[model samples]
Structure formats: structure tokens, C-alpha cells
Target chain A: MSESAKRQSALGRMMLDEAFEARVRSEPARVAEELSLPLSFVLELAAISAERVRAFRASQRHKDAVRGGKPPTKLRW
Target chain B: MPRASVGIGLRDAYVEPLRDLRDRRALDVLEVMIDDAQFDRRRMDAWRSLGQRWPLVAHGVALGPGDAIGLDREYVRAVSADLAAVGARWYSDHLCFLRVAGERGPIDLGHFAPLALDDGDLAVLRDNAAALREQYAGTFLLENPADILGFAGQGDAHGRESGRRYTAALRACAAGALLDVTNLALQARNDGFSAGVFLDELDWDRVVEVHLAGGRRSGGLWIDSHDHPVDEEAWALLEHVARRADNLRAVIIERDDRLPTLEVLLDEVAHARRLLP
Candidate 1:
């Protein structure tokens, strides 16, 4: 994959996966190297607060549920 | 310029309430999500009927204009048909990418993803916005996403520089801005920038509409949940922009989740109407 695609995929993962987001928060450089993303992008991902990640993840889940015709999980504020 | 009209986003949960508001002449316009009615003929007919009573504006959620993979021509055509069916006044969509190219096909992120804000992304956005504008043949507005997660690129750490760059990008594309005040407030609180400074950096004339909504605090960060009442900070930003944006034509109260009673939204609409020049 190209560098841009790599970065976008990593971002996509960060939005979809809780564990991956935690790993990015704790070890940004390693994740950056693993994904071939710029360290700067990883650092930015690291700076994202855990609450924001959870909210984004919940939103994605809600959208998925809606598409599947399932009831959405209530998001905890 | 005419005084900006105040309105509310169209929600299925509030259709009856909106009809009452329209009858009472309390609502000015209705911003409908084109995607919601695109696939359902019944829903499209409902929106078309609503359009006969109130002027409708088209807002899309899944266009992903900033996506590098390129525009979804099929989705664009569908949205265009829906817009025409409802006689929409203008069209608007978020300036962030919602889809990415996957090996199988395009993957929908299901949420707005912040752009890298580099030259390459700007070029993609410019080309897409121009194409969409030409296709719509009417006012096309790009809304700033509520960027909770900051991206590392050609901008200052506090997000002011990013705001400036966004304004310049909109100007270059010759598309108007649907300046969402709630998004701006969320970015300021989450990214640690002066919201006033960010507002000042925008080219006021290009800002055609303003979105006002409430958000909740999560993990010490303000999330654009749009489930609460319009916060004071966002209201202040709305007032500030209302005074400055001479070309501002509309202000919409956007409440997507946890919708309250119609009276509550009407109050917000009234408050926003009072702020207009």
C-alpha cells in the first residue's frame, strides 16, 4: 500500500478498534513503524483522548447497527 | 443582505412537530439529509411533501468529498435525484473523508475522518468540491468537521492555522462554507485553540450557513454528541459569526441523537433568530 493509504488505514483502525487505539496511545512510535506511517501522525493519534476514541467507536458501531437493521447500542456520555 | 433565517434539521422523530412549527410560521427552512431519503421512495415522497410547506436544503452525510479514492458517482447521482425531487435550495456536506479505498472496494468509516491537511489532500478536496458544485448547479457548502482527534500536518498545534488553511481551501474551490459553530467550539475545546481567533480567520463572506448544536463532556473533552442543549460557548460563537458573516443566509439547529421535544428545538431556533442582524 502507498504511504497515504497506510496512514488512512491506521486511522481507520484507530476509529474501529479499542485495543489498537490503546496501543497507539501507549506506544505510538512502534505502531508508527509497524504501519509505515509518519511518527508525527502516530503522535497525533497518541494525543487523542481515550474518551474521544470511545465516542468515535460507539458512533461507528451505531452506524453499523443501523445498516444491519439492528437496534443501536446506547452510547454512554 | 437579507436577515438570515433560522431553521432546524429534519429528523424522522420530529416530523409532526415540524409540521406544526411550519403551520405556526415558527420555522424558516428545513435541512434534510439527502441520504436518508435517497433509497426509500416513501421517505422521498414524505420529504417532497414537506418541501411544499417549507423550503428544503440538502445535507449529505456519506459523500466523503475529501477521500483520495475519488467521488462515488453513483451516490452523487442518487443524491442529485433526491435533491431535485425535494426542490432543495442548496447542498452541503462535511469536508472530511468518510470512506477509504480498501482492497475489496471502498470502506465506509461511518464517521467523519480528519484529513491530513497537506497539499495533496487539499488538491483532492478542491477538485471534488468543484465537481460537486458544478453537478449541483446551485450553492454548495462544505462544513468543517468536529475534529476531536488532531492530525499532524501543515498547521499550528492549537488548530488556528488549520482553520486558516481550511478557509483558504474553501476559497480556492469557490465553494461556500456551512460553518458549524458547534464543531468550531468542539475543536477549540478539544484542540486547545481560541475559538474567537479561529472564527476571525474565516472569510466571513463565504460562510453561507451556520450550524448550532449542543455537545456533552466526555473524559474531560467536549464531544460533538448533539444530544444536549446548545452550550454557552457555541451560542457565543454563533452570535459572533452572525454579526460578522454578512452573506450568512441560514442558521440550523442540528440535533441528531437523543432528540428532545419540538418546543426545545423551537426555543433554540428562536434564540438563533434573535442573534441575526
Candidate 2:
């Protein structure tokens, strides 16, 4: 994969997977090495405050609940 | 120039209420979700009826134009057909990637994902926007995604400058912008930048529509929850932009969850109409 794609993939995982995010939050350098991401990019991820991440996750969960655990199938008028 | 029209996003729960608003001359337009109109015949007919009554604008949630792999051609064709069916004045989708290539195939992220804002992503957006405009045979627009989680390479000054250049680039390719003022306010609040300065730097000539919504503060950041009423900060920013955006055409009050009475949203719409010069 290209460098940019790799970064996107890693970030996507972090956003979608709670366990992965936790792992990254606790051991960002190790995770970066395993994912072959640049140290600079990993540092950026590290800088994202835990509170912000929690807020984002909470919002996502709320959205899921609003959708009733199903992907958007129709317009909710 | 004509005054910008005010509208509300049509949702399932607001059908009768919207009809009432239309009869009362409180609504100027309706923004329909293209995805909802595509797969359901009954919904399409309802949207068509609403379109006949009020000017319709098409908006989509899942057209990830920023994907480097390119847009889904079949989906684009379907979207174009839906837009035609509804007689939409314009079409828009978020300028972010919702689907990404996965080992199995393509995976839907179920929400907007911020783009990298690099040359490659811009090229993707330009190409996709061009293709969409050609297929739809109408004006295409891209809404600014609410970047809650700061993406890499999007530092404050550099990111704002890159966004300006990218907006200009998209405009050059015939795609206008749908500026979500609420998202801008949230980003400014979270990132500690002056929203007014960012608006001043933007290529407003390319902005054809504006979205106003309400959000709540949570976990140290303001989330674009779209459940509450239009907040003061967003309304202030809307007022600021309304005075300056020369080519602005429409302003939509978007509410997706915790919908209040239709009268409440129409009141907000009236406030938006008052802001237009």
C-alpha cells in the first residue's frame, strides 16, 4: 500500500475499533512500529487528547443507537 | 442578485408539518436526502410531490468523493437519476470519504471521515466532482465535513490555507461549496481559531449554499449532534457569512435527530431569511 493509504488505514482502525484505540493510546510507539507508520504521525495521534477521543466515540455510539444498530437504510423524516 | 432562499432538510417525521409550513408560506425550499429517494418508490413519489411544491435540492450522505480509489459509478448514475426525478436545483455531498478499500472489498465507515487534504485527495475530489456534474447535468456541491478529530497534516494556519486553495480548485472545476456554518463554529471552538478570520480567508464566491444546525458540548469538544436548536455561535457565524457571501443562494436548517415541532424549525428558517441581505 502507498504511504498515505497506510496512514488512512491505521487511522480508520483507530476510529472504528475501541480496542485498537486503547492499544494505541497506551502504546503508541509500539503500535506505530507494528503498523509501519512514521514516528511523526504516531506522535500526532498521541497528541489527540483522550477526552476528545471519548467524545468522538460517544457521539458515534449515540448515532448508532439512533439508527437502531442498523446502517442507514432510509431517510428518517 | 436575488435574495438567498431559506429552507429545511426534509425528514420522515416532518412530512405533514412541512406541508403545513409550505401552505403557510413559511418554507422556501426543501433539501431531500438522495439516498432515501433512490431505493424507495414511495419516498421518491413523496419527494417528487414536495419538489412540485417547493424547490428541491439533493443531498447525499454516502458519496465519498474524496476516496482515492474513485467514486462508485453505479451509485453516481443512480444519484443522477434520482436528482432528475426530483427536479432538484442542485446536488451536494460531504467532501469526505465514507467508504474505503478493504481486504474483502469496500467498507462503509457509516460516517464522514476527514480527508488528508493533500494533492492526491484534491485530485480525486476534482475528478469525482467533474464526473458527477457531467452525469447529473446540473450544479454539484460539496459540504465541509466537521473535522472533530484533527487529521494529520491539518495544522491551524497551514490547514486553513490548504482548504482555501482546495475550495478554489473545486470551484474551478465547476463544483460549488455548501458551507456548514455550524461545523465551522465547532471547529473554531475546539481548535481555538477565529471563525471570522477563517470565513474571511475562504473563497466565498464558490459558496452556493449554507447549512445551519445545532450541536452540544461534550467531553471537552462541541459535537455536531444535530439534535438541539441552532446554537448562538452558529447563528452568529451565519449572520457574519450572510452579509458577505455574494453568490450565496440557499440556507438550509439541518436537523437529523431529536426533531422538534415543525414550527420551531420554521422559526429558525425565518431567522435565517432575515440574515440574508
The best candidate in terms of lDDT: 1
- Cα lDDT of model 2 by residue, B214-271, tens digit: 8888878888888889988888888888888889999999988898988899899998
lDDT of 2 by residue, A1-77 (tens): 65656666666666766777788778888988988888777777767777777777676656655542245422111
lDDT of 1 at A14: 76
DockQ of each: 0.29, 0.27
- On TM-score, the leading prediction is 2
* Residue B231 CA displacement from its true place in model 1, Å: 1.9
DockQ of 2: 0.27
Question: Which CAPRI quality tier does the interface of model 1 achieve?
Answer: acceptable
Candidate 2: docking tier: acceptable
Candidate achieving the largest DockQ: 1
CA lDDT of each prediction against the hidden true structure: 0.77, 0.76
Task: Tell me how far the alpha carbon of residue B181 in candidate 1 is from the true structure, in angstroms, after superposition.
Answer: 0.7
- Regions of candidate 1 where Cα sits further than 4 Å from its true position: A1-3, A18-36, A46-51, A62-77, B20-24, B152-157
